[model samples]
Target chain A: MKDLVPERYALAFRLYPYARSPDQDATAPVRHKAIVVGGGPIGLATALDLGRRGVPVVLLDDHEGAGLGSRALCFAKRTLEICDRLGAAAPMLDKGVQWNLGKVFHDDRLLYEFNLLPEGGHAMPAFINLQQPWFEKFLHDAITAAQAEGAPIELRGRNRVDAVIPAADHVTLEVMTPDGPYRIEADWLIACDGARSPLRNMLGLGFDGRVFEDNFLIADVKMKADFPTERWFWFEPHFKSGDSALLHKQPDDIWRIDFQLGWNIDRAKELEPARIRARVDAMLGPDVDYELDWCSIYTFQCRRMAQFRHGRVLFAGDAAHQVSPFGARGANSGVQDADNLGWKLALVVQGIAPDSLLDSYDAERVHGADENILNSTRATDFITPKTPVSKMFRNAVLTLAETLPFARTIVNSGRLSVPCTYDRSALNGPDHPEMPARTRPGSPCPDAPVGQGWLLSHLGQGFILLTIGLDAPESVMAHGLTVPRLALEATPELAARYLGGAKGAVYLIRPDQHVAARWDHYDADAVAAATARAIGKE
Target chain B: MLITTPNLTRPDESYARLIATHEGLDEAGSHALNARLILILMNHIGDDAVLAEAMRLARETGTEAA
Candidate 1:
């Protein structure tokens, strides 16, 4: 059993070896409040969120801990913010290399550069580049600390869920462990298994979408160099290793280089260390010295399941939707999924809200998945043109982009991932026209500095009524829920973000820090209705 | 708003100039020039509604001929 565990997990943290729980010896399967499968970033985060909310959750994983390779390297600002709320962002931000600038190149010439966050008073940077394993490791560390503090989060390693039987009220699962198979039931099951979701397959679901006819080889090389920490992408690179290449800096002086190897290549030969070193040598020239750390060839698809939720079973992360890795949306969006589902699922399990509230998770996340697929597909099309005419247009845009500023907008290396706004969600409540559109209903609450702490830190784990320059009750009880009021004097940044031209404003922020409703001024009835509507009462 | 009804004054001159701009270009160069010209014009017609209407008309004209 120990041999099956990857060495990477041993190198980093203690593995969660399978332990004999009493459920295995029970005559009847014991029921859990929430059961999350696949202890990747999404599952770990979901369990952590639920446990923090006092919901007993058990996470099952086939592997002991994080797998090999630095798969998902770019953690966006929104993901960091979500991690911050989960009490795991400090280690990530400390270890991950932060960068906001990206430069695009054609052959040997630099076309233009972009700053993801041009202006900022936000707490987190635009993005941070960290190895996926380290990202998962930090989450595990936070979970360990939470467990010490008596958070009811249990992680079962080597517990592979084999079969799922979903009933109206609970979902039964047959989990395989080193000790043998055990039966358990969960009120709600979250499948965060991954792009090739075994649970999704077990349910006989369809993952339908376009399969791009291109391949990329990621080679993480450890080296000591003084290259600026920024994303550099090249089209028709001068190195002649591939059609396109991307270079990014990661923690521990390791750099990630991706070469776009076209379809119909020998996968085994391309992964050979000698071949990979040759490509690296060409890209780096002779002066730079580096050691190859890890290499893998990947073929991506822009595909997703028809629906994220079915009966009592829910899907999150790559198990629900998938997109090309160009924009670094995979793990980032997965973390966002956990953030969105955590509070709602907790409420439903606690009987504070009806099961209908979970439907909003499906609606909002599906909206986010579609937006990610569209952007990544467009970026893939630009990077790998399917037709001669399309290639001509892409090259023309690149050529013009060298000199003209307008053409720069058309050049798409990869539109980096950003938070998705559920603009048309049914969960959205009233919006004040005078308020800024960026913070409208269904948008994530923009963070601002307030009294030596950030505004987002003030709004966590429950619904908040953030009133600025207005008088409201200390708390409001509506529909069997208590909405706490966070009154503050309007600061410059807060006014710009939450209150545009409006003199005073009131915002109803959901547990996930997304705005559910807003108004020009505080009203008790409006607040009650919006809070009810946000929980899917309407 | 997109003006499909005789919006351009001196239509002949405009057409002549468009043709004259590609006088010395090869097939690939001519195609690139046309793409650039289309991009510039699309930027000038920044309104999404107007640009979409023009794009639909352009595609429909090709399909109609086909």
Candidate 2:
């Protein structure tokens, strides 16, 4: 019998002694402005955002280092932009495989290939495939640097939360450390703990959704190959008797392969080294040299908590929701949740915005989670039909998609993750006439080349006014508003895209680079009202 | 310009009734029922040109799986 391959991702685990160990003389619990649990991508990103905003934060994680394997290998463009804002995108872009094209196959025949981003004006590409461990390591390094720079971010590893007590104004936590147990208090708690969140369990929250019966075997293998860096998905491939298979390339010559195993297959038997070797040997020619890096089996699920916010404790990432891995929505949506929550929490902590502003976080992210769940459920249902008629329709769609353009719309393997627009958000202000629909009130600001850099590089991290074809008002700064105004040169491309021949157009953009409002003329009172609405004061 | 703009007033109730019609049938039986319903609805419409236009509109506004 062949020996099973051991997991090979190397993560350096560092242990830190408990800083606030209990003493003989009783002392007041150390208070933090914000306490973030779970040091994964979402937690680290939230910590970085809060620290950059000068909000003191304490981050806790039970584990000492990165996760075991390359769990989430795809980072969407919006997520990379969020990471870029937090100062961690350069390492990811340098070490990740950037791919924007994908091919889908039905058995031996090729169905179609798609290009996610056909236009290339944006700074970030449509997608990058980097191992989850490397992504976390980059985030960790950023947090360390921020701490050194007096950002007041204390990352505590090997500290587990044993109890959670919520109050009207604060949340108390009982943390277990390497030395002993200690208690901590915080004005707000952000839970980024993963799918099986201990904090969520202690709070008695339940996820309300469906659990799929199908199981997928994921194997990461390292090999030197010349295959192009594009996603390849097969339905009932010739080498495997399963319903589906997926192949994706990651950084460092590692490739992720997923094979569908129907509901009743013995998972233990399927994971054996000999059986996995046979499967790999049949799929790739038997002569290829490869080494298994990691292997695991997972059942797909589409579930989420009814609400992500509970008083002072807010949940982000997999702790708040879980989706099937097909669409890459799990970690991507979590990062977006962090991005949305970070700015709002910072403002509230600094007393610049009221706590009611956090309600929009729940509303917007609930909408985002529902969107992810809906897409994930549809993709899973298409991939694994429950009824015979459903299966017939799915097959018919795939077969017809080969020649018919309309039928191609129904062929869904996975929709892939895209940023969600909060159009119905209550914080959105009035829209102006003749402006482009793409940059509507709740939409993220579209990136354009401004001189030598992208437009988004100049916008986010604070409220700003973008004026096109107009001069800034002389009294605009005296309105007691803290917004910085930028006047564009009305270049032909900018005017055509944003102004649409309407001169003197003004736009109010939020700290997260989402459009708050736009007007053909600037009114200081109106701008202040719009800014107030954007911060959830109205 | 838009003819088929939410004609059904009580869509949720109508949907429940429509699904209830196929409660106990097998795959082929359910498909036959669907065919029969389509024929009945087509006859109710009664105009051949309108039916053709409806078919074209339905085919044109293809369902996005996402």
Candidate 3:
């Protein structure tokens, strides 16, 4: 941590964000041609992805900069694979705290502990927890740097969006700029606006979903404790009247605790410091001292938009769905929404693919949104049961799980993330010799090593030809696939683990990284035929 | 068997009795009613597509005029 960041960059907190106009008073004319309303991680990730592809984007946020709050931290192996595809992987790895095991507790009892690193390939490359603002700042810089190189994603900090109007073909956005109300036009509009999306409601979309009665108070503090810094330590729920406590580490030895407020506490009193101190005191022995850095209250909601598109106007991230921040899905899935949309928009803008290709965005991501909502709900339900009988049943099962290996696997798979398979989709291959239970062809492209670079499942911008063999086996040939980009690669270890070393296979992967098709023998003839049919090349 | 129709599927007839809020409902009452409505709808649609689409549409403008 010390060696990677330079002293000049260490003072980054003070030098960056370059204070801008107050969102409420200032009124600047239209600054961005296509404005992104929120500057959270998803919005910034979207800005970076688009800026790199020569698309000018305007990112606006009311905050002077990214929030100082420690919101989301965990990154899954799947997410890291996506990050690697977007060129944000290296910095993320350098700045985060990594862990690969998940533990569960039933009151004072340790119910189960499953080590995930081994399951995801010894080093797994998963679940990195970093301060959300750090990534926000990193992405903001990435966007600026991309602009300096060529096309930059325009950023209008401390600016607020008051109106959005979707018209024929192009969408016009009326923004309450630092100066006066200004309007801008774009070929498309996306509401990465967030859960309280004014843009969503302005469109009359029903945010039909469940809001858990439970509330949580998250406090960031600098503390010294004997608990291992790597695992999510869960305090006994019963000891704290059925609330859970978390210990997450940030840079500079700062830790964040997400204190799950009991159902009985008044929502208004959830943020009182005395209530927070009491919870912390319960967790500590008589001696350890900790200083509170910051605190906030948040409730959990599990909901997704009924549709991701309203004509040319689209919604991504929080603007589209809100999940309990339990299994690291909220921000990760939202960033993924940006990655999925960036290339689709670029291709359509460049006249490479018909605009209808955007339909695939909704087709794929809405499903992914469902998956996130479900996972977050499962984690939440397990941590906080609704009824005493269900709590007792959950505890009994968890207790039984401690002695049973198979049962623990079932529980951990949902919480820690099993590899996502896109089995029943239009993009996958017909039948292949190398298809394994885990490697179900259309599933998210599995990780493999190709020379100095990592061969990942989720390619950011275009279709990829992942040919696995010792020396480019010539089996997976790309001939008629004409969407964005394609590439070929291999690794001995990946072949053994995922592809089962059948002299490898050729995988025609889509821009979203779902395998379009794969074959043991790559006759440019057959591969080309499959690619044509998959992308409607006929 | 009824497949989850996603965006195309609305709530069943029985769900009409459940409202976003009941008379004299406080925050808790409103939230509970909302949850019941969602559960009923989810049980019918099964797939999340419809709600995801609704969210996207709503964000495009404002609270759905429906």
Candidate 4:
């Protein structure tokens, strides 16, 4: 067993040693169907999704275990559903703090509280707050279990990719291990190597965007407190004069607190245990007993590479783009990136789809990144107003929110993460009238309770033809379409949400559960054409 | 379009409410609050042409006072 993780942090999963050191097999380069660099949540998810699709994947990571701290603590509902599909959400939900309400305060007075998920009947909550380490552990365990069950996923710990050479057909990687260095060839290379992506640098990709001038001090503390498991954000909190503070509860009696520090503050002094303790004491009152678990000072940047795809080398997660953590978009979007790329890459690797299908991943995720960046930038601007005028405007909005309903609309204290809809993709079939706008082409199929399971649970893993309140046309079977067709009775819930005012509908859904296209009536030709377009055959 | 004349039903009451909203503020704070109020009103009346005309009228009237 490799003892590579920090002793202070618990390692809940086993770390596998690197395969094929220089001494073991130096002459012949081992070839893999896909190689995912970085063993973070995104990389693990990509590998897991590919392995589940029967694609042989080799995952490399420089570190031997999970991340050092509770890096990204909030897991959005979409992300949880994606994890559930990958067989990792159960443990996360079981050991995570589930909450939907968030309270925002201006000074000591409470401004307002918002409910993320007011209605029920969904499989998961709006969000789950779990330590990133535990989340990664759950994913790691899922990958290990899948491998045990004959899934072709190879997790290589302490395997660092020193160099990347992109060829016409494949990518070559030089990996360094404890024993020595070895080379490997991959048909497709996925870079999930995080924000400071070494693979991105080796490939000479440029990441351009703005880096905010503000810094934040984050401390994860364990204490027994009666605070509710809800998100609390304070602007100019009395404890932290002229600054903002955020408090969120996690499992294991841990609370994550973030304090906004001006740009000129000393990072070292802010991170000191004594200073952190002082701040915590002031915030929680002098008598509260707590122990600091981890502390770090971070500056956020909103940036991305111009292109996520470079020939056979693809980028996902932080390696591809970065955003301020204000909106919890970082890890959530990365997970979505993995989910979006996994099935497309599987089809391409299996030679079932043209390589051009992978282009849709770039198009879709770049759109997603832009949305995340835009929302995060707005939240950051509102939280840390740079100019006096902007600050005054923000303060005025905060003031007016107490009485004016319209003013509350402009209050942006980190708009929570929601899955982006790929509304403008070229793969969507023609739109039809009398359909609900929410379930239109390129949008995620909203989950609703079916007979025993949710609607999302019934779709995906391949092209699915969902016919509601209608019989499958013989033309669909006559065409010998490989897409699985599921005929569902139009229950009231499904009818209202999916069918809308239409009596019936036929929906062609992508493998990632995004609605590729929908029509009021069954049209085999349209479905066939949309399927082809979806696989980049057109 | 821009409201060139007073449009409030009770101009004095509205003015008093506006002043009351900035009761505890000093001179600089009052000016800041007024600037913010203008921005909020501008956002509410989103028509650019109306905003431009209102700005022009305010500038002209202030110049005449000067």
CA displacement after TM-score superposition, residue A520 of candidate 2 (Å): 1.9
Q: Which stretches of candidate 4 lie above 4 Å from their native place?
A: A1-14, A19-26, A473-481, B1-27, B39-66
Model 2 docking tier (incorrect/acceptable/medium/high): incorrect
Q: Pick the candidate with the highest DockQ.
A: 1
Rank candidates by lDDT, best first. Answer: 1, 4, 2, 3
TM for candidate 2 is 0.87
Candidates sorted on TM-score, descending: 1, 4, 2, 3
Q: Pick the candidate with the highest lDDT.
A: 1
Give all TM-scores, in the order shown: 0.97, 0.87, 0.78, 0.91
Write one digit per residue (lDDT tens) for candidate 1, span A1-538. Answer: 5443233243344457678788889999999999999989999999999999999999999878887788899999899999999899999999999998899999999999998764566888888999988999999989998999989999998888889998999999999877788899999999999999999999999999999998899999999989899999999999988999999999999999999999999999999999999999999998999999888899999998988999899999999999999798899889989999999998898887889999989999999999999999999999999898999889988988999998999898878888889898887999989999999999998899999989998987799999999999999999989999999999999999988999999999999999999998888999999988888888
DockQ score for model 2:
0.06
For model 3, what TM-score does chain A reach? 0.86
Tell me the lDDT of model 4 at A30.
75
Q: Report how far off residue A500 is in candidate 2 (Å).
A: 3.9
lDDT of residue A189 for candidate 4: 98
- Which CAPRI category fits model 1? medium
Per-model root-mean-square deviation over C-alphas: 1.8, 7.8, 12.1, 3.8
If chain B of candidate 1 is superposed on the true chain B, what is its TM-score?
0.93
Error of 2 at A28 (Å): 2.3
At residue A223, candidate 3 shows an lDDT of: 79
Q: Arrange candidates, best DockQ first.
A: 1, 4, 2, 3
What is the C-alpha lDDT profile of model 2 across A414-459, one tens digit per residue?
9999888888898898897788887888887777778888778888
